[model samples]
Target: MAWTVPGLLAVVLVAALLTAMARGYALRRQLLDQPGERRSHAVATPRGGGIAIVVSQLLAYIGVGVLFPQAAATLAIFSAGLVMVAGIGWWDDHRPLPALPRLGVHVLAGLLLGALVWHWTGEASSAGFSVLLAIALINVWNFMDGIDGLAATQALLASVAYALLLPAPVAGLALILAAGVLGFLPFNFPKARIFMGDVGSGALGYLLAGLVALGLGTRSAPWTILLVPLAAFLVDAGLTLAGRVFRGERWMEAHTQHLYQRWVKSGCSHVMVTSGYALFGVAGIVLMHVFTWLPSPWSHLAALAWAAAAAGLWSVLLNKVHR
Candidate 1:
């Protein structure tokens, strides 16, 4: 609950150990992700390393709730939602499930999280918007998990931003989440020894959404301020989805058409692409904080302008690469 440095380090170490164990388990169980035309990696790698992150973060959340009973209900909602999302993702990782079933579970998790936000803020409108945002983040994170390290790294950046911008308990939660992902990153980045799989990615999306909702409910910052840190992911996933629909492509089909994917296909290494996106995330966070000083309406405009600039830069990179 205190989020002392030693306590956080301990959690990170435990997460790393758990992640290492999960990697062994995945190898023994043959839960490997094989390379494909759409995949970024060349060799088969163990998957589901995200289970460690999920487990560690959940444990931390429970610990926090126990220490701060006032937060118990909020943590309970988060834990429940995480279980539902991670459960379906775990199942899908080992045995592919129908899209409808997965989507249904996602919707359920969104509603639960939305309810949690509404409970805290006592605003029906906020709850409705949070529900929609949660679902979209879940799907977008899942869609962007095609490459090694991209999703996890993005989650790390966003969590760090949240930790910096938010207040006590929420900031502590964000830090714990960041450490968990940090522990998992070594097994995933540069060249993935294990993938986060759907389990990790989906849970992370939900977790980040929950953090944003918590910040908004507490008035730590405006909704747009919280959203700014996620611009890289939102822009890429949004633009790619729109492009797919416009081209009449099967939007749900696996493909390497994402900006990061395109960068890889154009001969950039996964590290380069991921780092580029990380910089985008960092920039967005910086801009969000800066805009907090402006008048309310201007702050909103500033956020939108920053996002548009990011989108335009991405478009230029995509075009240059393709050409």
Candidate 2:
């Protein structure tokens, strides 16, 4: 990687520039998300800005493929899956699509990712897990994208953490994503000028899942440690979704039932809630790195402990916060 520094810089610049362009297009086209009961923001805002991140990431992949021709097949597969996820999301952002159809596309993309990982690692279990993880994250990030800075910051932290934990190629991919998210964060945080929309959120989740799969494939670190960075978002999104489904509600529909949403409804600012999640993300990243130094059973056990603690916190938050 002689192109490492240049790739990162290019991604950041492209992401920022594309986000601005997307925002302008959204505004001109009147593609805005207006405040309502289901939404967290108070004002109508331009969306579809996440297309910037998607485009930037695709470019990064192409760049990598061009530089390292040996990785071209893997990158092509990865890029196809990404386009599938991002394409459906991009459509939904423009003209809302039904949940099942979007989900079908996600499943298809998941299978593609599963195959890619299977090819990389020659492991059936990793392939299976990759499928599940891709589907799970594609929706989780969308679910957690309700508040300002929350989704983007979590992505930034998770990608950077993966970059540190994984080996080359995959590690480089993760860093490029982190740089892209870093460029997109300012427009969305403190005061959101534009939203990532479905396009950005779902694509991000897909990319994160892709990175996790690559890490597993490369055997860069223990599988358990690779998952530690995503604990907070997963716990929040998973438990909230589980609770919804258990109650026989239309779980696919958007609502403000997440703990982060409840905290905001309970009078916390977006910055406060977002920053709090960032701290959890930072803590998880540190813990994962720490676990890398520990032995097998201990590292795995420690990761499980972190997840358990997150689940406990989820329970506690639900008890303390009133809708």
The CA lDDT of each predicted structure is 0.88, 0.92
Report the lDDT tens digits of candidate 2 across residue range 103-211.
9999999999999888888999999999999999999999999999899999999999999888765689899899999889989998999999999999999999988
Candidate 2, which segments miss by more than 4 Å at Cα? none
List clashing residue pairs in candidate 1: none
Off by over 4 Å in 1: 1-3
TM-score, candidate 2, is 0.97
lDDT of 1 by residue, 211-244 (tens): 8987888888778777998999899999999999
Q: Poorest 10 consecutive residues of model 1 by lDDT? A: 1-10
| Candidate 1 global TM-score | 0.97
Per-residue lDDT of 201 in model 2: 96
